[model samples]
Target: MTKRIFRAVFLVSALALAVGLAFLMVVLYQFFGGQLETELKNEASYLSIAVENDGAKALEELPEHAERVTLISKDGDVLFDNRADASEMENHAEREEIREARERGYGQAVRTSNTLAEKTVYYALRLENGDVLRISSTQYTVAALLGGLLQPVLLVLIMVLILSGIFASRASKKIVKPLNELDLDDPEANETYDEVAPLLGKIRNQQRTIQQQLSAAKRQQQEFSIITENMSEGLLVIDKQTDLLSFNSSALRILGAKAAPQNQSVLTLNRSEPFRRTIDAVLAGGHRTELLQVQDGFCQLIANPVLRRGEVAGAVLLLVDVTERIQRENLRREFTANVSHELKTPLTSISGFAEIIQDGFVKQEDIKKFAGKIFDEAQRLIVLVGDVIKISQLDEGCLPYEEEEVDLFQAAGEILQRLHDPAQERGVSLHLEGGHIIHQTVKPILEEILYNLCENGIKYNREGGSVTVTVRRGEDGAEISVKDTGIGIPKPQQERIFERFYRVDKSHSKEVGGTGLGLSIVKHGAAYLGAGVSVHSEPGQGSEFILAWRGKK
Candidate 1:
């Protein structure tokens, strides 16, 4: 601030000095060119009359002065001179002042003397006797005559310089004082300096706008911090340099990072093999999403630039813990592949058998078996296709339900009855015990949930495994459980088992003719009807799948 003030003062002083010097130059030119010319004019006119009356010889002999006098002919032939030989003088016939004296009685002109290399003024007058008088004065002679004027002009220049600097300082202060007043604490004090009130008002209004922007920025920062901190997935913000500017606790844990302190960079923060490539691209100003590996999981990074006034100030990198999102994406892709494969198997078998029959390749003795196999594949296709439709309809909220109150015991019995033949064929015992009359969404939708659960329970079972289906009432909603002595689910795959096309084992699930979508439909159905589902399972132990219907509220 002090430097800025001094700089402003210095600049004004320089301008003031320039202006003062220019004014002095003008004053000097005016004094010498105008006042001195008039003085010489009067002196030359008086001397001309003296020379005309008192002959050229008397004029030349009178003084031998450098303010010299000479006489010339009407044709500009020099006749007399005070200092130099008349014949040596240059021709003055072509001179305007000399020609004017011969024709118009008098004239004046200043020119450089060829002989002396000095400036001289010549005033010429026509004499009564028809000769011309030429009076000449060198510039030095005029300067000496105005010698007294030199001291005053020099003094004026000195005074101008000193006074200009003083006024410049005072004027600069007066102009800048308002700015100092603008820095005062009291907002009201800004108005007292009326000389700059409008400008101050504009500054205050702009300040208010800046404060508003700062407040909005702070809010966005706080919101971004909250999201990064509280999210289950990890997050990181990297700058254009790919240095870690900020990150949440989840990011640290995900990166397995031990080096990212408050001021440490991303490079400093346990930069393992995966993050290096992403950092490189970001630093190189690549605008794209880059995926990197951190620890054992996946990190999806998006690199973008922060622009200020149309230039890139830095980059912003958003790091997401796609460990789960990637898994979900892989699951969805796999699910589609599995569904395609499952549907194709039945179709392929049917098409092959049909082709054999059409081509007359199947022997008459074996045609019945081929027919039966074709029928079975067709039936499996129907079931698989129906399950797909059911799950998709549930997702789209298109599955219609009857909300009539149904006895939980009756519903459980009916679902178990549908599963009894399959259960008995597998040598699995089916047990149903119940005690509730719950008001819930029912009919076409509710019956399917029970059937799917019971079938899944028995189908996934070991031989002679018992499937206990229970229906009971709780404090608010009804409870139903399908406890199965099947091959239990692993801890990791448990969460995703209810998703579409998921199976514990594909070969075993195919042998059991499972569509892999029944549980997903069940989950979505329960959720749509405002119910809750939970699970309890161990790796070796049996699993319990429970659904609680929402009570009328």
Candidate 2:
């Protein structure tokens, strides 16, 4: 800005100086020319008077001067010349001054010399005797006049340039000082030139708008950070160059990264081959997913491509923990296979016995025995099917029952009565003890829980062993316990006993005559009623299954 100002000032000053010099030269030239012409006219009149008085001899009698004097005859012949030989001079009759003087009383003319370096001004007067008298003087041309003054003009121009440079620099600094000191942050508050006020107002408006936009952007960034930090699933964002842009705490934990991963390459976090391949595939405009065993558990990694204008810009990686889900799927497959095998055994027995009777392969006396075996197998199939249906309903949480206040003691008594025949067959004595402890729960679920527990106790007990049902009210809640002198569960298998078709003594499962879903039913039914079941047992001493419910106070 300062340089431009200085240049403008210097140029204007130099142009003004050049124009002034040219005008002075022209004015001086015209003034001097007029003065010289006037002097020639006066001299011509003076010489004419002298020659009129003294005849042609007056030219020779004139004192030596810078002016040239001449006399001409009426017939175009030079009579006398003061500066040159009159006899040898050319005729003056055809001269412009002589011709004009003959027409008028006096005439004047100016002419350049043959060499064109100088000019002469002539004034002619017609004397009374009909002779022409002329006076002439020499003057320099316009070029010669300027050449004589060249040194002085150059010296003055040089002085002007030096002074202009100094003034230009100082003026430029003065003009730019206000702008340099302007407070741009608060443009409207600055004290400066009125010509700059509108520009400053525009700058102030833009600054306010930019500040608002910056504040809004900062708020959004904070909100995003808060949300991602609190999320349960791992989230990571990367750019097209595979550099990590952002990541949540969950992502850091899932990847087991020991450092904050911002602005680092994705490979710096996890450089496993499979992980790299998945990221590469996603970044190439494709979506990829894989299950990875990371650290102590299983994670489902989903890499989705981010697109902008039909091109892949980056990728978003989502990691979901699916360890429990995987375990449940495996359990489901095993349950299905076990159920099929369990059902096929009884079905095959029934089919074989019935086919023998129908084919008449068995004698008449063996018919009753074959029919009885078929009936027993069919009954076992029905029991197995019913147990499966009950378990399915419990799992789906659609078992039909209503919540009500029911006495645990009474429910236990009813279950004991129903299992009397089974108890007699197993030679296991049954006893009910404890007060009438009232608990708020679904009645059917409570009954189902007690029946399965007592049944399991009787089925797995030795002959002449005892099964006891105890209902008691404690400070926490109502508890119903079924204790039996049965073959106790082994410590290692205790946790798995609640699973479907899991029998502690599988070799004697058939002789025990159970669908192998008794304890499973008890577990599910107790869970539905919001109760807890635990077993206190040791090998061969006995086992106690306790069901406790914490009723609302």
Candidate 3:
């Protein structure tokens, strides 16, 4: 703005100065030409009179500054010349001024000299003797006039330039001062030019609009942060340039990133070859999924390309924790293997004994004994199959019995009565204690729980050891405890005791007359009833399994 204003002022001033100087020079030129013409006319009048009175002798008496004088006859011949020989001069009768003087008594003309450097004005008068007397004076041309004024013109131009520069500087500053001091943030509040008010108002409106847009954007960013921070799955967004655009807290935790990873390359977060390849494939418009073992657990990384106009613009990474799922799959595989082994053992024995009887390999008297052995093996197979089916149903969370209110103590007593013969056979004493404790649960699941606990107690007991069933109301809810004075489980193996087919002493599994699913049933049944089960045990101090009905309260 300052430059433009200064330039405009300077240009206008220069143009005006040029025009004024040109006009002044033209006026001065015309004024000087008129004065020179009048002086030649007067000089010709005086010289004509003097020459007529004294003839050629009067020319010698003429003043020195009175330039060239000429005498011409009526017959077109120069009679005498003061500046050159009369014989060598051109015919004066044919001259422009003399020709006009012959007809009009007096005449005037101007012409340039032969060299073209000087201009001469001619004035002539016809004397009383019928001859023309002419006076001429040389005047400088317009070029010569301009040359004489060059120094003065240059001085004036220099003065004009200086004045214009000073004026332009002051004007430019004056024009820009208000704008420089203006508070653009609050444009309407400033006191400035009325012409600039519209621009200021526009600035104010745009400022307000910008502030509102910034505030809304900030709010949106905060909402996105909150949602992603609370998510359990890791999320990441990356651009096509391999720059990370966004990273959530879950992603940071999953990648074990110590700092926020925005605007960085994905390789900086995870430099592993597989991770880099997965990102590359996704960026190339492909979808990829891979499992990575990270600090927290196994994470399933799923990279999906984000498309724009049928081209890959970026990608989104979803990280799901699959550690627990992998563990459960492994457990299922182990359970399948154990089930096949356990079922095959009894079936093989039953098949062998029946085949021996059918093939007549045994003696005739031993046929009944072999048949009895096959039946016992078949019964063991049936029990094992039944336990497998029950465990499967429990795992699927399918309850075959309806829930109802029942006395926990009564349930314990009934389970003890059912296990009395087994306890006696094992040489273990059975006892029940505690007051009545009622709970609302599935009756069959409760029965299954109590039956399994008591069976485990008697099955793993030492000879003459006692199994006690106790039920009572507790602070949290109903408590049912089955403690055994038996060959207790080792401390290290206690955690796996509730797993299906997990036996503390595999060598004595058959001797204890169990399929190793008794405690597993207890665990599942208690879980189905919304109860908690824990065990207190040491290697030689015996074990106490406690089932607490926490939901009943």
Best TM-score among the predictions, by candidate number:
3
Candidate lDDT values, in order? 0.76, 0.88, 0.87
lDDT of 3: 0.87
Rank list by TM-score: 3, 2, 1
Worst 10 residues of 3 by lDDT: 58-67
Q: Which is the winner by TM-score between candidate 1 and candidate 3?
A: 3
What is the per-residue lDDT of model 2 for residues 280-319, given as tens digits with 9 covering 90 to 100?
Answer: 9999989899887777777788999999999999999998
Q: What is the Cα-based TM-score of model 2?
A: 0.65
Give the poorly placed runs of model 2, Cα more than 4 Å off.
35-89, 105-152, 208-239, 245-260, 267-327, 341-391, 402-553
Q: Write the per-residue lDDT of candidate 1 for residues 1-553, one digit (tens) a residue.
A: 5445555776676677667766766677567766656766676677767776687656655654456777788677888887779899977677878888877888788787555556777787887888877776766433443464688867875776677566656766777666766663345566455666776777778878888999999999999888778976666666555566777787677767764766556777646655566566655656767677777778776767666676655666666778887887887688789889989999999999999999999899999999999999999899988988887787688766657767778888888888778888999998988775656565667778888888888888889899898888766678888899988888898898887887877888867877788888789878877787788887667789998876652
The alpha-carbon deviation from the true structure for residue 277 of candidate 2, after best TM-score superposition, in angstroms, is 4.1
For residues 454-552, could you state the per-residue lDDT of candidate 3 as single tens digits? Answer: 888888888999999888777888898899987788988999999889999888776877788888988988888899899998775678999997746
Instruction: State every prediction's TM-score relative to the real structure.
Output: 0.52, 0.65, 0.76
lDDT of 3 at 221: 93
- Which wins on TM-score, candidate 1 or candidate 2? 2
